[model samples]
Target: MSDIDLSEAVWWKSRQSAVNGNCVEVARLPGQKLAVRDSKDRSGPVLIFSGSEWAAFVAGVKGGDFDL
Candidate 1:
């Protein structure tokens, strides 16, 4: 993966996100990849993950895999 020009990236918040303001933004990059960052700090380091990887994480979340 090369450098990503996040400045042009359009981030989308999750639909399931509560109205409590605890939301994250995801940007679609080239080459079937995605960049995720905290909505509170857009300038923070992003956690880049592949589309498949993100899907798996979502599945895990829906399956109660990360329930504390």
Candidate 2:
């Protein structure tokens, strides 16, 4: 993932996110990178992910890979 302008990125919240109004959002940045940040903390730290890695993560989520 290369340098991205988080300031211009449009974040979309997770589908499983609840209505508690405290969920973070994910935005697809340039170079197929995934950017994440807390919705409640726009100025907070941002996490970046590569395209393939992000895709695999999404697939895992759909497959309940993190389910205990």
Candidate 3:
């Protein structure tokens, strides 16, 4: 579990999110990290990733690495 404080974190989801709100929200965190959580489960667990990790994930996404 992370010890980061997110009491004042501002979160946002992609503009392309579905109408049903089944999407994830992301927040910028301290020390170049990021926090991600399910939009439907605001009080649930959060996933944290480092800047490099997030960049790699974004690159992979743009490269269609996760394409079905």
lDDT of 1 by residue, 1-68 (tens): 44777888999997998787678899999878899988888887898899899999999999999999
List, residue by residue over 42-66, the lDDT tens digit for candidate 2. 8888899999998899899899999
Evaluate model 1: give its lDDT: 0.87
For model 3, residues 1-68, the per-residue Cα lDDT tens digits are: 45899988999999999989899999999999999999999999999999999999999999999999
The 10-residue segment of model 2 with minimum total lDDT is 1-10
Q: Estimate each model's TM-score.
A: 0.82, 0.79, 0.94
In each prediction, how many residue pairs overlap at the backbone (N, C-alpha, C within less than 3 A)? 0, 0, 0
The lowest-lDDT stretch of 10 consecutive residues in candidate 1 is 1-10
Query: lDDT scores for all predictions?
Result: 0.87, 0.84, 0.95
Best by TM-score: 3
